[model samples]
Target: MSSEKSKYIVSAEWVERQLGAPGFRVVDASWYLPAQNRNGAAEYSAGHVPGAVFFDQDVVTDRTSPLPHTVPSPEFFAAEVGKLGISESDTIVVYDGPGIFSAPRAWWLFRLMGAKNVYVMDGGLDGWKREGRPLQTDLPEPAPADFHANFNPYAVTSFEEMRGIVTTGSRQIADARSAGRFTAKEAEPRAGLRSGHMPGARNLPVGLLSTDGRFKDLASLKQAIEDAGIDLSRPVVTSCGSGVTAAIITLALHSLGHEDNTLYDGSWAEWGGRTDTPVVTGEA
Candidate 1:
C-alpha cells in the first residue's frame, strides 16, 4: 500500500496556502461535453479562482486534426502557454469543475510541452467551493511570458504505435470509457461513432480513479488499477472517448509511480470510427 503523503495530488487546503506565491500559476482547465451545453470560457469569465488563468482545451489543441482535442505541436503549445503567462519554470496548478477529470489533460499537456513543475488540484473547483474558498468574477489580464518547449514524443502514442501494440502485446492498452461502452452494451454519446472497446484492452473507467471528482488515496488507486488487470510493470497506453478523459488514467498511473506510459490522443474517436481497426465487445 502506498502512503497518501507520497501522492501527486494537492489538496484544496494546500493550494489555498500557496496562493500568491512567486512563479506559481493557477489554471482553470474546465471542459464540458457538448451535451452539457456549457461554455468553459464563459464560465471562467464569470467566476474563477483568484490569479487563475483559463486553459482552453479546444484552442490549445491540434487545429488541423479531425479528432477532438488532439495534442498540438511543441511550437503551437509553446505559443499558447506563452499567451497564458505560463513558463517552463512556473509551478502550475491545474483544476477543473469536478475533481481530477479535465485537469489531468491540461497537466499532461504541460508535461508534454516540457513543463516539469506541474500538478493537478484535487477535488478541483467543486472541492474548493465546498470548502468555502474565495473566488473572483473579475477576469485577469496577464502579460504574455516567454515559454520554452521541449517536445517529448515518448509520452504520446500515434496511430501507428497503437497498431503495433495491438499485435506485439508489449504494452497494456487501458480504455477509460464506462463498462457499458467498452462492452458495446450502450451506444456512444457522440453521433456516428461505433460502440466497442479496443481489442485486447482493459476497461478502467476514469471515474474509478476518482471519488466525487477528487482522486482517491494512492493505495486505493493502485488497487483499483491492478484489479482492472493492468500490469504496472509493463508500458501502458491510455485511451478514452476522445482522448480527453484518457489523461485521467495517465495521471493515476503517474501517481502510482508508473513512469512508462503514453496517451492515445485520438482515442476511440479515431479507432472506433474507422472501419479497419479491430474492435471487441464484452469484458476483458
Candidate 2:
C-alpha cells in the first residue's frame, strides 16, 4: 500500500491510545441498509468506542433535497459538525460497525469541508470489539466548537454536470452498486426507480474494494478498479445506490493518489428515479 494511503486510515490500536488525547476526536459513522437490520443510533447507545460520538448519517443531511443523505450545504455541515465538537483542525477518526463501510463518507465529508486531519479507523468497530478494545455505553457531551467551512465545490458532481459527462464522456463514471443492480438482473432496494445503470457507467461494486469489512491491500484495490474497467490515470466520478458506499471508491482512489475524482452526490437515487436520465441494462 502507498504510504500516502496511510494518511487516510488508522488502526484500532492507534485509536484506543488516542481516546483522551488533546484535539483528537472519534466518530461512529455507522448506517446500515434496512435489509441489514442494524440501527446505528441504538447500537451506539448500547456500546461504542470510549469518547466517540455518533454521526447520524440520516439526520445530518440536506433536508431540502428529496434524495437520501444529500451532502448538506457547507454552512450546514459546519454547524452540524461544530455541534459534535469537531473543529476543522482537530484530528478526527471515523469508523462504522463494518470495517470499511459508512465511515469513509464521514471521512470524505470532513475533508471536503476542509478538515485536514481526518482518517478512517481500519477494521471498524467490529474489529475493535473482536479485539476486546474499550467500549462505553454513556454518551459523551462534547463541548461545541466552531468548525469553519472551506467546502471544495470541485469535489462534488451535480446532476447537471453528471448529465453532461454521460453525454460527452468527459469523465469515467464508476458505479459502486452491485453487479446485479448495475446490470438490472436484480431489483433495486428503492422503489419507483429504474433497475439498470446510467449509460457509460462501469460497475465497481463497493464490496470489491474491501474484504470482510476491511479494505483490500493497495495492489488488490488497483486490480479491482482495473477489473471493473476503471482507469486510474483518468478522472473518475464514483456513484452508488444513494451516494454512501461510493465514498469507498473515492477513499480507495484517493488512497492510490488518484486525486482527479469526484463523488456524484445524487447517485442512482436521483438518476434511476428520474425519467429524463437515460438508463441501460447489462454491463458496461
Q: Give per-model CA RMSD.
A: 1.2, 1.3
lDDT of 2 by residue, 101-187 (tens): 899999999999999999999898889999999899999999999999999999999999999999999999999999999999999
Residues forming the 10-long window of minimal summed lDDT in candidate 1: 1-10
Alpha carbon RMSD to native, model 1: 1.2
TM-score quality measure for candidate 2: 0.97
**Runs off by more than 4 Å, candidate 2:** 1-5
lDDT (Cα, tens digit) per residue for candidate 1, span 1-284 = 65583255788898889988989999999998887677778878877888899999998999999988899989998998899899999999999988777889999999988999898898888788888999988888878998999889999998989988987887999999999999999999888888998889999988898888778878888888999999999999999999889999998899888999999988999988888888888878
The residue pairs that clash in candidate 1, if any, are 99-213
lDDT of all predictions, in order shown? 0.88, 0.92
Q: List the residue pairs that clash in candidate 2.
A: none
